[model samples]
Target: MRRLLPVAFIVFGVISGVQCGFGLNVTVSSFTKSITSSIGNGINLVVKANASIKIAADDDNSGTIRALIAVSNNVTTPLNRLLGSILAAATAENVNSDELFVNIFSLVAETRPALDAASNAASDLQKTTKEYLYQTLSGNLTELSTILTNLTDGLDYLHLQVYQAANEEYPVTSKNITIFINSTVIADITMPLEAIQNYLTHVASVITVIASERTQVIKYLTQMNETISNGLRNIQNSASGFNRTVIDAYHRIMAQQVNTFKNINQTYAAIVSRASSYNGGDISNLTMFLSDLVAANASFLQFVSLSTNYTMEQINPVLQDRIAAATKTLTRVARFIANQSAINISQHANQCAQRFMQKLQQNPVVITRLSRCIQQDSNALQPTVTFVQYQMDLVRSAASSIANQMSKVCQRNTGACARAYFAALPDHSQVIQNKISVIAGVVSNDEHVVTGRIINCLYGTGADIIENALLMTKKFNRCMLVGP
Candidate 1:
């Protein structure tokens, strides 16, 4: 019995030691699990915090980036609009200049010499009519009428000089020059400019008709004047010789003829002065129109340059810089959050590991080994964090670099647009410039020729011939009405 009791006590002692070891091991395991759970919770909180920060950053920046983009679009839209409008206007002006150039070319080639011929014909008719009238003031009225009519007919036909010259230079039926004087060009400018030519032609016709009859009719007027004078003198000398009715009639006719002659002479002088002034005004207006075209071309070029500058120098930088700045800010904020989260997680892991090691002193070997492992994990996390940080830096750098690249692309596109615009412009712009210069030179040369010929002819010798012819027609008609 005594021996059995000792065995039972020894057995109880052994079981107690085993239970204590098991309890200690369970406590260490539970503590280690709690530490691990705490580290996991800390890591989860850091991840949540990082996610929340990113969401907040996106919210903060998106509106600003969008607004800036909107503003950039708004600013650049007008540049495009202005470019389109300016190009349209330039094209319209170029068309107008081209039409004018053709008209001027036709004028210089055809209308000019014809005008000169008409003017010469007018001068010749005037001189010949004047000399015939002065020399044969007392000749037969019928014969004088026939001779003046023949001479004036030549002058009147010269009115066709402009039309003939235009037809010859740019044949209406033929191919080459006729194409330029189409309905559109003609309607826009040709009709108005050519109207002047027709008007001058009509004037020549009138001068010829009037000059042919002037001196011949004047002879009849002189005879009537002489007869009337004789009758009035006789009536005064002896009232008994003529009746009261005859005397009054003779006096009235004489007064009417004298007034008509004086009026005709005054009208001739006035017309000559007015015609010269009118032609000068027309020339001045044409030259001014050409000058305005030059000014418009210059303005077009200036506006194009202004639009290009606004796009490349102003709008492009503003857009690229703003977007890049927003991206950088977003990346920087995310990196900061990630780094902070990593730090907080690492700290939590280290603190939990330290607590776990402190509570596990009964299992020194296991505790030491576990602590070393936890530290190694923490140390390993540092490289992961560094790698993440490096990746974030790359993202940030890429955002900025992409923005810079976009800016370069924008600049390159802008340059390409400018080049395209210039390329498009040269077809009309260079041709228009060349046409304008040619027109100016031709206008200058032709102005002298036209002035020397047409205007001077109408004002100088032609006016005198027309006056005499008009007077003669009136006198012949009057003489027939009042029998000599």
Candidate 2:
């Protein structure tokens, strides 16, 4: 407390102003009053400086005590704000992560229904193709049987003509005539059979080849679709659980930080309160305490600034990028699956029908007369079975091309999709490592700033101010500092 100044000023001024005598008589009352006022002014200035330090040790009306009274404030705002900001940032980040997970999960769910539909379409296409094979062969067989009768009648007439013409030239033998007639009938009858065989061969070629290819494609599709759907579903479940754990940890980290700030503030405030009551009417300790308080405020501000930098520059930006990448990659994978599931081989059915119809229209083997076929056996009316073999080859080649092409495309697309999905899931390790490096640096820098700069500044400022009151003259001290 600064009680020494006013009393010393009044006593010294009166003692110096009165003439030295056996009987005490005070002569310069005005001079004593002027000296006391002058002394008071100087001490008042020092007291005010002490008061500003936030810890006032003395209680008095004069200069030093007044300064002591003013030092009684506390450190508060910056600490609270620093902790609050951290909690807010953590809360926001947690919410965003949760939202991203939900979106990806929903997209994965959408693919299953589409996959089932695609499988159904494959089954329909197979049925239609099988029915076409059955109907075409059954109707064409009767037409071939009628052609056989027409050929037989023509052969008999030819034999009769030959016999009639030869009667005038030579003796006709019944056995030679019978042999010739039988041979002609056999030739005529076998022609239509060859045509029927050609038709059956081509029909059989389409049925066997096309059916086998279709079965393989559909089986591959079903397996691929099921694998993707199940894998995504598993990933979605696991990722969501992990995210919840991270979010909860983040919340706890933020809460602990806030509590740590509160504890620090309370400790310092209590210490400063104790510091103010220590020395007898001396404000130097209080002044020093106030300096440290101001410095602590600076330290807290630095901590908040650095912590914020860590989040904004390192943690938050990385989190946002991860969220976007996760969302984008997951959505892309889901879309591929859904689109594949919706892939209808039904669309290609029309193309197959159109090609089959056009081939029948242009076909000399199926729609034309037996005369249209080039004969392999000259003596017989039977057309070469070679046309039937070629037509069978053509139908087989066309169906195989379409089925194989579809299967190849589906395999290529789904294989790529599977690779990409796996790539995205395993990507988190690298991203997390990057974020850890950034946050680690920020934490180190913030700790240094808070513990080193602000704390050191406060201690250094107050440590050098010991006996600062003695720097003034005796008269100055009488006004500024109270004597023990």
Return the top candidate by TM-score. Answer: 2
Model 2, global lDDT? 0.32
- Give per-model CA RMSD: 66.4, 64.0
lDDT for model 1 comes to: 0.29
TM-score per candidate: 0.15, 0.23
Per-residue lDDT of candidate 1, residues 1-484 (tens digit): 0000111110000111111010111111122222122122111211122222211112222132122222222212222232222222212321333343333334333433433333333333322233332223212212322332332332223223323424465333323322432234223322332232233233323333332233223333333335334433432333222123222322342343234323433433332344344233223322333344345435433443343233223322332343333333323322232222212223342233223222222222111121121122222222322333343334233322322343344444225432342233334334444543342333233323422332332233223333333343344333334422
lDDT of each: 0.29, 0.32
Per-residue lDDT of candidate 2, residues 432-459 (tens digit): 2233233334444543343333234323
Q: Count the backbone clashes (under 3 Å) in each candidate.
A: 4, 9
Top lDDT prediction, candidate number: 2
Residue 51 of candidate 2: its Cα lDDT? 28
Residue 237's C-alpha lDDT in candidate 2? 48
